[model samples]
Target: MAAAHRARHWSFGGVVLVVTAALVAAVLISFSGSVAPRADAAVAAQTWSDEFDGVAGHAPDGAKWTLETGGSGFGNHELQYYTNSTSNAALDGQGHLVITARKNTDAGLGCWYGQCQYTSARLNTARTFTQAYGRFEARIKIPRGQGIWPAFWMLGNDLGTVGWPNSGEIDIMENIGREPNTVHGTVHGPGYSGAGGLGAAYSLPGGRAFADDFHVFAIDWSPNSIVWSVDGTTYKTLTPADTGGKKWVFDHPFFIILNLAVGGDWPGSPDGSTAFPQTMTVDYVRASSSGSAPVARPIRGIGGMCVDVAGASSADRTPIQLHNCTGNAAQQWTVGNDGTVRAFGKCLDVAGGSTADGAIVQLYTCNGTNAQKWTYTAAHDFTNVGANKCLDAKGNSSADGTRLQTWRCTGAAGQKWTLG
Candidate 1:
């Protein structure tokens, strides 16, 4: 699990100290090859695209989704009552699902505290659309003002068997009215669970509120990695290295969830400035996979530079530099069904398992560890084999003298790595 907090409280030093401590603590948490005989003629590689022509609507086309309602409060001290009713959720003629939050005066619709005062809806696709690896996205306009919490997220359908963080939750978009234009995306799993889970905020370029208009929020889920983007601009990414001691919760199928809640622990209660009963409009939600297939064959003797390596002994850190891939056991990797990469019997962990540059890479045994997971991008950079840092070169150098490193990536050429 990974998390980020609003920087409203701590001073710069205080924040740095806390992050440093977290990195130090991460250092202490020490945490597959296959070839297939192709039966069919090779097909053209699928070009990436975001077309939602076949997506299901409110009723959720198939078993891909289920409605969740009437829980004893979803960790937040919310006022609205949750119900599994189509009346609360429906598709508008404009090709969108409208989940409305309304004041409910009916005494029959009661809450655990007493008579219900409000009603809302939560929809998920755990059964019907559970996917292992794919691109997931939703175009939505959030509700504004204090106390409103609307989210577009994913939860492992294995909750009944695996339980909570172990099952994993990927929050693609979450906005509390108080925060307005700032939308948050995050991943939740064991080890890095709760308030400190893996996540980040993407404020509108000029710092505008998301409630103002519909925006596309998405995550590209590949074997062992996840990348977050807003309107096509990459903001953050998470790989196996970010999972810490937790299992690689993202490897299985996850269903979608969309809900609007009123007030909670994180967003707090509505203040005098808050408006009543705001609304969240969702244009559509889409999921796409890399089309089920075996790993591509490695080009013999054609080495690609390592660019980044994690999990080496501290003494070997400097020498564990990037070199051309020689199809060696060290270079060959297998992305597991559970979205993790396995190689050399260890994980491709990030240095200090951090998202910052100059972080060292160290290897450790896998225990669903986040540090070992990674996301490979079309841009060729390998993000956290566990969480969100991207592979980077020290100071943008292609020179042999330049050190290889991981850094807060800007998608620069020097940070890109390729495999053939």
Candidate 2:
């Protein structure tokens, strides 16, 4: 997310890394296939961690985080003046980092609007640590108010050189007080920054507000993809193919940030419904990277064509078929941790949610049902749950437009598949 409204459309993908263009291009091509399912044995090792294990009423570990002091609205027309003072940010003695936002009408305190009306704290790991690919997570309990905006996110490490969007931004978690039950996870890159970012929201189940309790927010970042999740439930995944063919810029390291802004253009200013001395509590932050990188490749079968969505459409219920692989987004798929083979933000589904043989397989909204889940093995056989049938290329046809369906697993060539 761009900090300033005037620079909202700025691209964060500018700083080219030391990696060769060919290598980067290869990374993009590799995602057209399947992502190796996140293996339990291959769990990424912890690389960085902060458990908020500090004395109550003391500052956070100075070696891990630095307070960002400013009253410049943070480029979002924010009402808060960030300070390093313990009153705004400090350990709660309960093993939590409490970031408090209070009414600050003190004339001595300056703000872009002349006198600061609110006070908060923004902390970052800018100069201390940065990581390229890993799983970053935090467990947080946010504050509630009409205009309170709390966020846990990351910015590209090259921000010093390329500035805003050209350096990229990944918002792992963002919640505005007005939508207490909902939170957002978004990625900003060239051509899709600011309000145009590609993202999705995950609301608390049973209509519960997030501020009522602590929830884990995280992102599993890999070479060319990122998966966003809450409380271990994966909700969204993004890759280069989802960028409308724009440059993929999240190849290098990025630093983490956490802040609680009183008011901003998006959240507006806290009103009568809002209260002062609001605090956002954080339990911990952790980062990890896997020793074995997972492989992603296209599932090709019946005449060597890839399993594809008909017409490259994003519309629901589009028939999935055997088509000529052209490295387009339509053919790109990922085997997710939740047992789904997905593309275009949808899942490969059994039409009518049926369990009968010959059930048509199409693209549908991912609802985590048995019909949407598939167990893909090294043999390339996709066995559907509930239906208890295998994904088959009808009539063993290799021609484009040959619709795929579920049939009794014959172990035939039509059901057999290969990764391209």
Candidate RMSDs in Å, in order, are 13.1, 5.6
Give the clash count for model 2: 10
Clashes of 1: 44
TM-score of each: 0.63, 0.79
lDDT of 2 by residue, 5-103 (tens): 222311122122211111111111113234343343234467778999878999988888878777877667788888889999999888899999998
Writing each residue's lDDT as its tens digit, candidate 1 over 266-365 gives 7776778876556787787776543332232221111234533333222223223454544443444444333444443334456555666677655444
lDDT of each: 0.58, 0.77
Q: Which segments of model 2 are wrong by more than 4 Å? A: 1-41, 44-49, 93-95, 105-108, 132-136, 198-208, 218-248, 286-295, 385-388
Error of 1 at 170 (Å): 1.0
